[model samples]
Target chain A: MQILFINNDGGGFADQIKIPDGTTVSDLFAQRMPGRNASHYLIRVNRQPVASDAVLQPGDRVSFTPTRIEGA
Target chain B: MRSASRALLRLAGKIHSRVESLQPTCSDLLLPDADWSRCRAAGRRLEKAERRGWRLAAVRLRRELRQAMEQLRLEMHRIEDRLTASERPPRIASLREILDDLRFLPDSFDEVRWDLRQEMLSVTTEPIVLEGFPLGRFTISLDWTRIGFTRPYHVLAREPNPAASDEAVTHPHVLNGKLCEGRGAVSLRAALESGRLVDFFTIVDRILHTYHRGSPHSPLSEWGGVCCPGCGDRLSEDDLTPCERCESVLCLGCLSGCPACRGLFCASCLEPCAECRVRTCRSCLSSGAGCGSADGSECFDGVEPCEGGRAQNRDSEADTHALLPV
Candidate 1:
């Protein structure tokens, strides 16, 4: 599955990657988030950001955002 | 109800929900399918060790999750603090005459960042000028990690402006925090050169004093006047003593004789005259017999003030006495 991570916030970073079978959103987010700060990150599966309860499948794009996003 | 308060309550609720959901349940860390099947085989392999005890492994697992949660709390607090801190004003905005001197702050930090990068490139780039004063040349480096974690919204660092750093390194008098012996200018210039770690009281003092002079809101009216130490009016070098005292502008108003010490003193250095019940200049008073400290404390026990001048008891005494209203 192709996963796309997009962080639109200023001072943000993003990446796109292909995931293997049975990769949960929580697992993907844990891998993506920085050490010790992963739990604080808001994980979004696909285009819709969701809470940790959301699950992920093959071809899912996951984004991790530090809760506060700045505009302008 | 007020719109802002309602919005704030909504924000608080969302934050509370997010924080509560962060705690992991038993199945939260569990892997599915292949990972679980492989884990079963691994567990079987570890069965011999498990016989000895799975207690250590369970303890390690629990400890790891607990540590992660602890880290999460700290990160949440830092984010909260940074967000709230922005709502408060930048302390520098309150300095007197500071904005007037600089006009407008750079609209964006882009130019500053670019300049800092370019200066760092130059093998011989002189220190960048700050607040019209010069500083010694210094190196610049981007602290992306610090910017990432501590203050995500803004680029923050202790990097000095080129001119100010050049002046500091070149001039033997200045340091990272202390001011040089000039007009002192409300200590704003010093605080500005210092990266974000501004001294709060120094800025507050300037703010209060600035307000005292005239406008409570204006930052430009906070100057202590440069007056003569001789006549008790604004000091003029042509026919006055323009000596600076304790980094503040010494005006002619405070100049007088110390009754006990009889030394020619500026108002800052003067004490109440022993003979006449009025403030006397330190330069006109003797140090011991009963002269007080610059702050008017009668230190009878022993410690004398450093740097005293001769006490003048001439006909100037009558003229000095005439200045203070009886």
Candidate 2:
């Protein structure tokens, strides 16, 4: 039931990480990064939109992509 | 007998001359078109000229054959002369030392990355005003720097202010409702040092909230920086990810949306969600029933079905393998 979680801009080296089974996409993001808000990131499960409450199944893959904020 | 032989040879020579005379000249055949039918038709008008070519060639061949016969006769009449000519001079075999001299040739030169260093210099510093919401002004600095062999370009840096109760303008980690303000000079320097320069043009869409009603000049984007396709924000090279499925190379800002199935995909290769119609990676295809063979449509486009043009064709398997993967 291991799930693969990857973040492009995770601020650290582990761009790809494996989470335990039953881990949701939202959960993986929370575990990998403690303080960062999930709302700020565009979290996708298996290439589809998923709610934060949705639990991840075995073999599920998740991505944490950040939304662009504009400034000088 | 010699006279009759000469006459026969002369007749042969005449025929050969006629053929040679009938042949087309190189200039006459100047046109690139080599169609035999057109040339044949044209040859009707050029029968005499075209015949010259064959005649000349035949005459040349016959002359050579006659010369050979004369030579044979001479050899038979003068055996001593033939024997004397048969002796050959001894060959002086020797190895050349020129190759040894070539060892002194200079080796080719190339440059290594470590040998090069990037230099950064601040060009200008000034305060920039943004009249948009949560309205405020910040100090912006212009920097010009060169990276390796690349030409130098300009970058804009803005000071960050960390919001704190003490408001000493000294703290680095203060949040002003997602926009920290009033950070100290040292912390601000650190933030500036860490901050990456992004393109102003690409992220202009995001700054739509800040556009003034009657501004004469449009916002300018930084040159040579990669932009996020999704939000137009500038992305650092490391943060840039190219999608395997759709071939969209994007920054973290616009990295979502699989090109194949419109499914959400991350910078890393991950499958699309089961609930969504967006296309995901090859690994996740089996889990989603609709994918791979969803609604009976083909999972992959551009590739022909099992028995189309490529299926019947052979000898192209190597070409197909090379093209499809990339």
Candidate 3:
């Protein structure tokens, strides 16, 4: 499955990424952010907030925004 | 017989003529002297009636005015009483008395300064350990003048957690990084009146414990989590929305998104479209069809212009440069 991911970091970037079916939000976060804490970032799907355990579907628009942007 | 009837009819005619001659003629009644006398009698009666009516009206008006004045006087007296009551200063302990009470504090507090200008007593306590967390040097300010029967003596921490970033942690009831304990003025007054430094220290200790524990009781906690600025409801993190422009964290109720650009905004920062009633940000308003008119008559269509929208537009224009990059 493919999803559109919007990352509001460093000039803001949006890209489509392929993920395995039934991938949870936490799995995606761990894959993208590596060792960073999940609580430090706000994750949203389709412009709406979603839980870490929420399963992702194809074509879902997800956004990852840091809770506090540095130097903001 | 016929001659007798004729004589009778002649006599009746003479009597009628005599009666008519006794009555005054229309021309005679028209004379000024006669008319004036009649008019004066009627005028007196009318004048009497008018005077009586005016007197009655005046009496009623005076009564109403007197009642109003009495009410106003009573209101003024009530307000004056309240003013006197509130303006009466609370009984406060003198500087010497406060310093004497400071003897109760432990020897850990090394330095003390009485700021006469600010009416505050500043104290520096040595580094303390609470729950395995080493609290660096802490400065406490106790305001004497502000402490009394009703007013709460404020206890503030000047340097809270010297080693940690100020933004890294949030302390409940702490304003501007100062620890403010107690529910309200009454509780605080009681604590201050106790004149025990241990009581004050306990509050500081609790603040530090709560900070280290990362579970300070927030007023918004009762509402399930942080309160939404828009609806005043408690919401969890999952239900929150961050404003793209102001970065304000708000709940769905207090947040609106532009349908065109999908940019989230706080309720106060978003403007409703004059046509569809959908909320839109200023950027969307300029670029999209948010400002379109329904019938090509006016940009606002037939809907009344929202005061918030107008004020927001004016404010946005004033800060356009700062807001544009966001």
Candidate 4:
């Protein structure tokens, strides 16, 4: 299934990507942002906050925004 | 309520059009990105510069860090904080998506607003009280129409609570109305370029909500303090002295006392009297002190022209032009 993934972290970008039908929000986050703790990001599916185990559907808009972007 | 929602949708559309109309400039924003990177790198270098227990290298690196910050400031002045989606913004958000982003904001964000005519989208963050210091709420406004490759935003202090040491610095990472996005710049650009309005605002809000001790424009501990311009020492407001003449507040050690009036004044406000050569404030000498002779300015000292004064007081420039060997 294809899902729109928006990663609002370093050099933020959004692009449609192919994820397996069973990919959970946590799985996608681990795959895309390796070594990064999911606790730091506000993960949303279809513009609403979602649980880590929530399964993403095709055409779903998913975004991962850092909850604390460091300021100078 | 319908009207308000429609207005918001229109505001979102204005941003959509602006983001859509951007022409990627020939120049890449990498200049500032590089500058920003250098700044961060410079910060890190200081910590590692003296790992071998040598101090000279740390000093040199500190100077380099200052230079990098200066360059970043200069480059920031040159570039518009806009987007740069090379070939064109990818998959510009539809009006509905933009509206959805707007609607989704109220849940986590304090407030959302915009000006259709001004083409601006704004988010008012909840009061940012960092480390027990209330810096007041900030308004993060995005000039969506100015959207280029990066987000064009400015943060305004709604209640105007400024740093005690520097009024212009309302927040540690913010100077005046602009934010020193620092490490957040790249992510903000990415979100803006992709028309992820929600992400863009949230990222900025996160930046405001968070603080970096090493990269602050000004620290919060000094929020209630002042820096003495004379000695360059940080001091409380009561510890400073106000110059009697110029009214510039400075530490007492840097001030000079006038000989005649016996009053304290800044060094610049005291001039040496012509007669006794005493450093005197302007009020001590009569207004007519320098207005006596034919030159109108030569008659100094508020006294009768002395014997030596007559010799140098000759007004005749006649026969004085003996051309010397040049």
Q: Best by DockQ, which number?
A: 4
Q: After superposition, how far is residue B80 of candidate 3 from its true place, in Å?
A: 32
Please give the distance, in angstroms, between residue B325's alpha carbon in candidate 3 and its true position after superposition: 51
Lowest lDDT 10-residue stretch of candidate 2 chain B: B107-116
Error of 2 at B45 (Å): 92
Docking class of 1: incorrect
Q: Mind giving the per-residue lDDT tens digits that candidate 3 earns over B228-255?
A: 7777765554467678878788887677
lDDT of candidate 2 over B1-326, digit per residue (tens): 98744543443333233223331111211222333334444444345544666553354344334434333332232233223222321111111111111111111101101111222212222233334212222322222222111112222223432122222221111122221211111111111222211111112112322322211121212112356675676544345665645657676555555434565455555554343444456654544333333323343353332222222233246556678865
lDDT of each: 0.34, 0.35, 0.49, 0.73
Cα lDDT tens digits, model 1, B243-289, are: 33333334435444444444444555556645444565444444443
Model 4, position B61: C-alpha lDDT score: 82
lDDT of 4 at B236: 49
Docking class of 3: incorrect
Clashes of each: 45, 46, 0, 9
TM-score of chain B of each: 0.19, 0.18, 0.32, 0.57
Comparison by DockQ, 2 against 3, better one: 2
Q: Pick the candidate with the highest lDDT.
A: 4
